[model samples]
Target: MNSPAFRIRYGFEAPECEPQLESLLAHRSVRRYSDQPVLPSLETTLKAAAQSASTSSNLQMWSAIQIERGEKRDRIADLCAKQRQVQTAPLFFAFLADHYRLASLAPDRAERLEFTEFYTMAVVDAALAAERMVCAAELAGLGICYIGELRSHPEKVREELNLPRGTFGLFGLCLGYPDPSRPADIKPRLPMNSVFFSDVYDADRGIGDYDERLSQFYREQNMGDATWTQRIQDRLGGPDMGPRASQLEDLRRTGFAKK
Candidate 1:
């Protein structure tokens, strides 16, 4: 009971944890960073770790573009809703769901790239690879924040990155040494029973308990009184997805999800 991982993540008690479980449960998004740089050698190692992730049928339909500090980096940061971490992080990477490489390799048989299934596969591949890289970076004492706002202006990102027809800018990542002064705290999640169902789905297992816990967390973090349910409502209850509303059209233009 009162295991470190459970305490930090669920605000409850659980059995003891292994080191790897503790590491995974301790993840937090760090926006403020120290001036310490992530070395190029370490970057390579992290990339290798990403490459080690499993791919769909070994097609490996994903790629990452490192953006150094420059005009292009600043432009991309602006494109990602002008996030301060994006502009200032020591290492930035744009993870792409890329079908271009495979299509190019077999140009005559590239018809399948336009299907939604292929698009989904590419996105899954990119996510898996990026997660592997993130785990490796965290193990190396580096912190990261993911920028899903990269999809806000997909066309602009495509043009800026010189991406081909079958490559989509899925997301961006910011990595650096975390600033001690502005440390991030691990946020609580719903109870395991609420999510991990036994045999069949159980709608009766509501998130009322989690709402109370997350409300407390929000108050402690000075993040206002919005509970997780309220947050979800605010995000999804409206049709105003801003520029992301054009995502389907953008994806089609980029030769994905056409089916």
Candidate 2:
């Protein structure tokens, strides 16, 4: 089949089937913007969609700080390895893994908000909302990029955003109109065999194929040999600790010790 979407993603043919997909397969992240502001209706709907995501045990633990000020964006850009796109984007959102909201609402200091301190749930809840926001933004004709480097200086980010205890900027999202000249594509994922498993878990079964396919995809994407192993080595292999390894103290200050 001459399906542009499948070919663009896989560089091979995929069987076209009957399904009402949202056409979001054309997803791309935009770093440039015109002087025009995002439509207010779209903004309202996007927020509604972000809120609509499922919550953990109905505790609803995530919060997002929508950024509009240029000075604030400039400061964040400075902290995030001076990525100029951080400042250029019309909208930036600091997606907070907000346990503080639930804790603050506790009737008493010793009321024992047993749920807040659990590390695993907090991450899951926050991630779900952030994922929802991304899908919603895409549906709204907006381009978005995830800023994982917000963790580079969590303390600075917290101070800048005035984040209270039990809340941390897990990540940032940049949103705006994508520059047509510089387009983005859906990052490829391994086939179902690698990630999805049946009753019993299995390992070391055809994993090498994924690494090779991903390497080829990365090269074609003009990303310069972005193989999974090379990327992991650069990110994780260090004679000294990298940016993320420096976060032990910051995480403590933000009020969660993995223990």
Candidate 3:
């Protein structure tokens, strides 16, 4: 679909241009980083930015563990499916859905933390915090890639990080300056009509021309021309979730989602 058609169909209007909005709209996952180092002071500022994100009921049930370069970092990278970004990023953080601190504060009420609601809250808190940090990093000219495979081997992650009972490693973040020689492009997204709905959900508003757009994008990136529908089917149309199949059991062992 053309831009005019999309705007007319979606009742869209052009927003006033702003640097922050432009940066956010231009977001692309950068797997390759340059040799530049992320300064310690900037790291502290990014942590502060993460802490500034809104939390559920002011619970602030999230924490981030910075993984320094060493054997432990290498092991954690291995646990994350040996992703190059995880291995080589100048700054790596394992964001956690953490209820341990709160449980410790109120030992008598610790049982409440085992409920599914608390687990959901913790996960939401962690995600919001991470996104805020990512935004700040992007604005500061750093690139980032998220590693969801952090949960692929949850038990091993816990062992590597020495996580307490009430904490769960949700995901990992890799941050560094983007390598100029290995640029990443902002991938095409589904049209807004397919996602955003009116008062009620509309299931029939299928992805309009997004399959073709994404296929072209893949071809440009030298990736196979796989449609989004096929990718979704390949990812979720099976019973096996690979190493993540045991995630629920691992979460229970870590004192989450018991209910």
Candidate 4:
């Protein structure tokens, strides 16, 4: 898996490969899961891993809500645009960009949390923490998927989670044991030259041959006739990016990502 994953991800093999690199390259968003229950300890380990991630100014401006399996989880899944993975996963987490706790500690300066830069910092902090947890889960052989639909109906999600004014649901995470019958493929990414740069940024290092590569990959997976560029344009050009076009107002109302 290491050798193939590395080859597929980079379009070439590394001169030397380590087990950690293999684990990282092997990542695929797993949506289908088996009926096996997730160990309770796994949540603790993941949270610990998340806390270990670097935060902006050590502000720790992120929090998460784990939805236990039941009616609440089903409601959350429906809120996330009927994403079945959220409903079926053994563990579901709504990761939040939170300034509410910190603000409570100093009521007089709570207004500082309303700034756009602070909101951006919180969003980045939450994303970093969530990624660390995802890495830990993958290392432990647990399958995971990130659900961005949580932001689609920001006010509704806030009401459902009982979120405070200075906290916003940034995304959701689904965790479970992978159903081997429904395997996930490694999606192709842009070439290293296209994304990584030295010193000054290189804006012209386009997608290279990724379109063709991903087109074939999609066809092999029977995922319909959508190229990478087509998908990107369709998602970004339209107002319907999963009902999230008007979410900025919701964020402003919730005192997050405002400017």
Candidate 5:
């Protein structure tokens, strides 16, 4: 059987690109999932893949909890802005920025963990691990969606998971066998030249071309057309980040982001 032809779904062709690399370009967020359950051994391998991600100086300041199906998952779904996928996906991983383990190892050096840089490292580490896991899952023909809404109610999430101090829920990942009946398209991204630059930064070029491309892509998906600039404006225009506006304070309360 012939492999599926790959193209830049944003309305361009990159036939010169190697076929193996093209699979990475074909990623799409799968919101709807079938009732199939991901096997326990597969999940173990996925976590191992995540753990293989690089960490800053090998600090490994990250952790994840696979929420089991039950009342806890239901509560967690509500905590994550009530995303139905969180409730129904075959697997859910609450990735955390964890400093607790390190602090516990050397309580005398705990003061060093209070710096903002440490907190940033933890968040970055968690993100790297999660993305690596996502890549592995996609390779295995599974679907995934990131739930950034897990940051909306940080304290509540801590309570739901019984998280200790020095651990913050960075985000959630929903994993499952995708429901083909409700397919999602590969969302367009900024063109390479616009994002990748040489030595010095060139701020002259704007995202006008990408905005137009994405606008057309949205229309093709039957969603109302809107420029990428407009979407960014809508998302970042105000300090009204709802419950997430208190993230700094929440992080502080969790023993991170301290002065």
Candidate 6:
């Protein structure tokens, strides 16, 4: 593979590209996979990369559960709204927004740590860890998909994972060697001007050309008939972004580090 010219035309257009930089730009989410399993060693490496992420106040409040059994993977896929990749991927990791570890460390003072359960900090911690796993896995030449739908039934998921109080499954990752019969590409992102602001927050810079560019990409990808704005509206359109809309409170009950 000589690498796609798409790499040359990146969001930053940074001519100074390394091998790793090239791979990152060409990132894609693989939904289909071969029967091959991700080895245990690779799993360990990915976990180490996730743990290496910096934390808020150095409170490392997150964890990953590797689901080993086939039956369990099937159940998880079903819970995630019958996403076939969940079951097909040889390795499934449940990423957690965990406060239990820290809470347990101070059993006597555990009542005080209960103050972290508010705001979006804990969510950020979990998201950061999840993203690290994604980067590490891709670097190792594997394909990955975030199973946010796993939150379809939070309490049920907790029970399935045998998670104790103060820990919650934020999302899941499905990983495997991709099946060549299927294909993937870097999902187009908003233009740099739309998301990357300079100096103060100037939202007026690039809001103009987003829909047309995004619609072109969407049509090419065949993800849907809607344009970028239309798709987004459909996403938050009605009440049902997904079946897991009820998960927020479940998160609190499962020890979300909320106050």
Winning model by TM-score: 1
Give candidate 1's whole-model lDDT: 0.91
Q: What digit string (tens of lDDT, one per residue) describes model 3 on residues 1-259?
A: 1243233223344444454466776678999999999888999999999999999999999999999888889999999889888989999999999999999999999999999999999999999999999999998999999999999988889889999999999999999999999988777778877889999999899998888778877887889999989889888888787988888899898889999
TM-score of each candidate? 0.96, 0.86, 0.93, 0.95, 0.94, 0.87
Give each model's clash number.
0, 0, 0, 0, 0, 6
lDDT of each: 0.91, 0.72, 0.88, 0.89, 0.87, 0.74
Candidate 6 Cα outliers beyond 4 Å, as residue runs: 1-15, 116-119, 241-243
| Candidate 2 clash pair list | none
In candidate 6, position 133 carries an lDDT of 78
- For model 5, the stretches where C-alpha displacement exceeds 4 angstroms are 1-6
lDDT of 5 by residue, 1-259 (tens): 2223234453456647666665576788999998888888999999999999999999999999999878999999988878999999999999999999999999999989999999999999999999999999998889999999999888888888899999999999999999989987877778777778899888986664788888888898888898888888988886687987777889898889898
User: Can you tell me which runs of candidate 3 are displaced by over 4 Å?
Assistant: 1-16
Error of 3 at 186 (Å): 0.3
Query: Model 4, range 111-230, lDDT digits (tens) per residue?
Result: 888889999999999999999999999999988999999888887898899998999899999998899999998887888788989999987879888888888788988888688999
Runs with alpha carbons beyond 4 Å of true place in candidate 1:
1-3
Q: What is the lDDT of residue 6 in candidate 2?
A: 53
Pick the lDDT winner. 1
- Any runs in candidate 4 off by more than 4 Å, and if so which? 239-242
lDDT of 2 by residue, 195-227 (tens): 778898887654545567778777887778777
Local lDDT at 220 for model 6: 78
Cα shift from native, residue 169, model 5 (Å): 0.4
lDDT of 4: 0.89
